[model samples]
Target: MGRPKTSASGASKRTEKDAERALNADSKSPTSNSKKRHATKETRSSKTATSPSTTSAPVVKRKRAQSEVPTADDVTSNKRSKTGRPSKDQTKSRSAKSRESEAPALPAAINEVPQDILTVFVFGTGENGELGLGPKKNEALRPVLNPFLDPSSPDAFHIVDFACGGMHTVVLSAKNQIITWGVNDNKALGRQTDWDGGLRDVDAESDDEDDTTLNPLESTPTEIPAKQFPPGTRFTQVAAGDSCSFALTDTGLVYGWGSFRDAQGNNRFGYDTDGNIIATQETPIHIRGLPKITQIVCGDNHTLALDTKGDIWAWGYNEQNQFGRHLFGRQQDSFVPSQVRVCRGNAKYIASGPYHSFAIDRQDNVWAWGANSYGQAGDPKSAGGDSAVLRAPVKIQPLCQKKVTTLAGGAHHSAAVTAGGQCFVWGRIDAGQLGVVFTPEQIQDENSIRCDDRGKPRICLRPTTVPNVEQAVDVACGTDHTLFINKSGAAYSSGFGFQGQLGLGSSDDVEVAALIKAKTVRDRCLIRTGAGGNGSIVADIAKRN
Candidate 1:
């Protein structure tokens, strides 16, 4: 079904609008069902929040090819020239060899993960196991210790990196192992958790002690079998979305599982015709017919991959125009991963908000596309409302001057970290999504910054710095809140926290940047942070001897 149309009155959450659609009136799902919404205001948090709102800019041209120069039709058939290009399997083999001598060197910190052993901590409610804190203690109003995954614990996994999806988490260990936890309703776990035939008693959540035993399979972290990938696969990175997961091999191949959801909830996972339509992949499958890949980023329902040749490949939900290219007919063609025509140049770095996409080219130019209902795509022209979506990737004027090293985005807001260590946030501002505050005179520009009936800022259409957050090393975003990690190894946050995502020992939302000073995280040197949905997570290590 197509999406619902929203007004320019400034509401930016898509979930609120979806709830307005009753099942009876919309019996059969048509793509346009994404259009019937009754809400006139946007909320930073919602129980059924997943899809992002719409907003726009002048139409930019869509461009992307599978390889160096193959047409969209050739990419659909998984070929280069369809006549002169090598076979699919042969193409990968040859590309790997050629990439060694041809592909440009990536930036020094692109996709780099922490090297030290991590002590993971989770905050907020994990009703869907988003926190990975297990059943007995699912709610963490403050940042609490997660002894189950800590390095000091016996038989610890020695986690080095992790990713946060809408309600799940993916971890990478020192042994090149990929461990998954949380919601698996869509096959995002990548492995069967029912080997025992019956749901096992785990954690003993009841206060009756000896009388209590219960374990939800998705609550605990478990490794996907090595057999899922070829022998000696050597996975280097892992990524997750609302209902999908992907792992990248050092050899530049990609394997993925789970299904990408459409506006009406059903989405296909494979790259074939309707006869091959699979609702959700029960297990991990090697994604075929792609060039050698170096990195992959997952948005709410779309996946973007950067091949060694420097071109970007995209697939999954494109209703919000995340692909930056024209998509005709149904989304069946979207299931096939193809090159994205991004910014008329090769990208050196890429990032994703839940419903939008961002890329930084080798020249340090930033481009954004997709859902802009709340101006999350970095285009001021599209900041007014749902109809302002950026259909194609366009260079973000403010960020073009800053050498952005990293970016993290949420439902309708985004944060960027530049090589100069400055952190800038923009988009939906009324709900405190932006970590910094602005004065009345600072936001007087109407076309760029939207204001409500009371003159309170609704959105900031440009990259504005978070006043107190300095020397930011990294940044992470939840559905509405954001977490900023600094060089001193301390983390700070701002925005909606009715679910305790702020990690401030309370569910109250904060407008300005606040230090995460729970009893558990205090004095601890947090090395990294991850967030999504209604939760937040941070990992810390002890001081070295």
Candidate 2:
């Protein structure tokens, strides 16, 4: 499967057309039988209703089906036994037999899979059809299944992981294969084929021309090759920021693509010491001059990498010191990757929010840096004068002893998960992305919560724990919302509900909080679910055996 084909009208209308196309295509394919399985599964799940906050705008309600939840036993049992752990050979054999017996008796539609795919596919603002879905020119509010993953074909490859940036998306397959679509304005598409010509310059002068010429290149999905690496070299992970993309190869080398030169060509962002920025390679280019990289992350205009030794390196836009090394008065683009001294210890993970940065050290302590305009720096007392930004990493005192194990950075907010599975949030709470589901008591506390040095309300700038939550396994942040998946696979969402990103059935505001259930499940006990977002919420869950 290739990226979803764009409709005749353009990207803005792509979603409506894409949905129709998917239905039509599935109708014609030999997978229609699976539709009944999905329908049947939906009828067994329970649904929960959450009250909308008074502050949010009116929104339409959407019905959702509940999904079967997976158990810890499923995950653990699926692992191959090395030590003396219980074996699931009997369970695996039974599942194989059941699947064989239930193999589609007739043709089915690809979209009719019984299992809900939780992955979120987000395309940035495609004002010019840069997202490649066609000229609809807006944010995609839901996960658009990658057409490249053919559900009908048993041998079809599966996307193991994916990441999205301001305008592009990248997916790494189970076979170590990489696929990308959405937004190639900066040559971020990687490589181009005969179908994908180099960047198409839209001529403003010809706007009144025929529809064919209005946006000739807008609807096509192009495949990019990683040429700088060895032929057939596979990637372990891929990430994208505002305008650039990075891929970490299995060999431990990093490759970059997209706009290299900054607004001024003198110093480009995303480039290495050797000037290896693939402005138009249409293929992956190895990032020159770096040791083996263990992981990579990208901010709006910067990049961060963690080596096997746990050392962090950063480059690109430093206006807000997102690089976590430069001092306030001295800031400039780092064409080459440089060590971020602040994360010298055994760092486990690193994340970059829109204009801020975060990291988890060996002892599970969280640190923050960069812009603090909305107290995103995690220090309420620190005075971020109209322009005071931390050029380097600063430890968040409140969470130092909490044993933080996971971290998520949203556009302006951040979240952390403690080892005990408790969630704590901080930074920008205007949209309630902080999960501050304000009860009457909490609302009163909000009234008393002291303001920061700038005389602004300190909406828990420090790590304040979320109430009535446990067994959380994963967490994700969107531009103005947050989501969590419990060990049981149940999902909870809070924050900006304008786009229905919370999946609470409506776009109404949720000041304090709410746990969401899909419409498919009737009995909540057997259901499980997961959630994520690009511009909207994407969730999934599997049934336990």
Candidate 2 ranges with C-alpha deviation above 4 Å: 1-157, 193-223, 226-228, 260-267, 270-282, 327-333, 383-386, 439-458, 504-509, 516-545
TM-score of candidate 1 relative to the true fold: 0.76
Top model number, TM-score? 1
TM-score of 2: 0.64
Alpha carbon lDDT at 403, candidate 1: 85
Candidate 2 CA-lDDT value: 0.53
For model 2, what is the alpha-carbon lDDT of residue 346?
77
Q: How many clashes in candidate 1?
A: 21
What is the Å distance of residue 231 in model 2 from its true position? 2.1
Worst 10 residues of 1 by lDDT: 65-74
Residue 416 C-alpha lDDT in model 1:
93
Against the unseen true structure, what C-alpha lDDT does each candidate score? 0.70, 0.53
Candidate 1 lDDT (Cα, whole model)? 0.70
Among the numbered candidates, top lDDT falls to: 1
lDDT string for model 2 (1-545, tens) is 01111223433534453353343231111111111112211121112212345453222221211222111011123555677664688567678678857764532211111223223322222333334353323334333432334333334435445565554556555545555554444555565422222223233233432222112232233334334455445566777765567878665778877643232332244443455553433455567656677778876667888877877888766667777766333424375667777768477788777567888788767788887655667866543244447766789887887887777777556777877888887765645778774445543464324344455443555666777556676676765677766666566777765445566666555656567665432222222221222333233322211
